[model samples]
Target: MSQLVVEWDRLNHEIEEMTALVGKKDAEMALLKAQLAKAQTEGPGTEEVKELRVKNAALLS
Candidate 1:
């Protein structure tokens, strides 16, 4: 039916949008995780990981 077709089209559009958003979030999460790992390995005061060190020092202190 026409109504069914319309509903299917809407759902497909929504799925496409959701997929794009999920991909973006996944990329962001991957970048954050890499940064966190780098920070952990590089020591606390280096420019790339200064924030991580500060938080860890504060927690320990």
Candidate 2:
């Protein structure tokens, strides 16, 4: 019936909207994961930390 068709169309539209939102969130999550991996790989080994470690060792000695 026409009513059923209307309901089906509404459900399909909702599904499409939800699918697009999920896809956007997935892309955002992938970007965040990449940033996290980069940070983990490159973190805390800079000259500043090395200098701090040397100062701490001198103080302790």
RMSD, one per candidate, in order: 8.0, 3.5
Instruction: List residue ranges in candidate 2 displaced over 4 A.
Output: 45-61
**Model 2, poorest ten-residue lDDT window?**
40-49
Which whole-number lDDT from 0 to 100 does residue 40 have in model 1? 83
Q: Model 1, range 1-61, lDDT digits (tens) per residue?
A: 9999999999999999999999999999999999999978776556747777778999999
For model 2, residues 1-61, the per-residue Cα lDDT tens digits are 9999999999999999999999999999999999999997888768879999999999999
Question: Where is the poorest 10-residue window by lDDT in model 1?
Answer: 42-51
How many clashes in each candidate?
0, 0
Report residue 50 deviation for candidate 2 (angstroms). 8.8
Please give me the total number of clashing residue pairs in predicted model 1: 0
User: Cα deviation of 18 in candidate 1 (Å)?
Assistant: 0.6
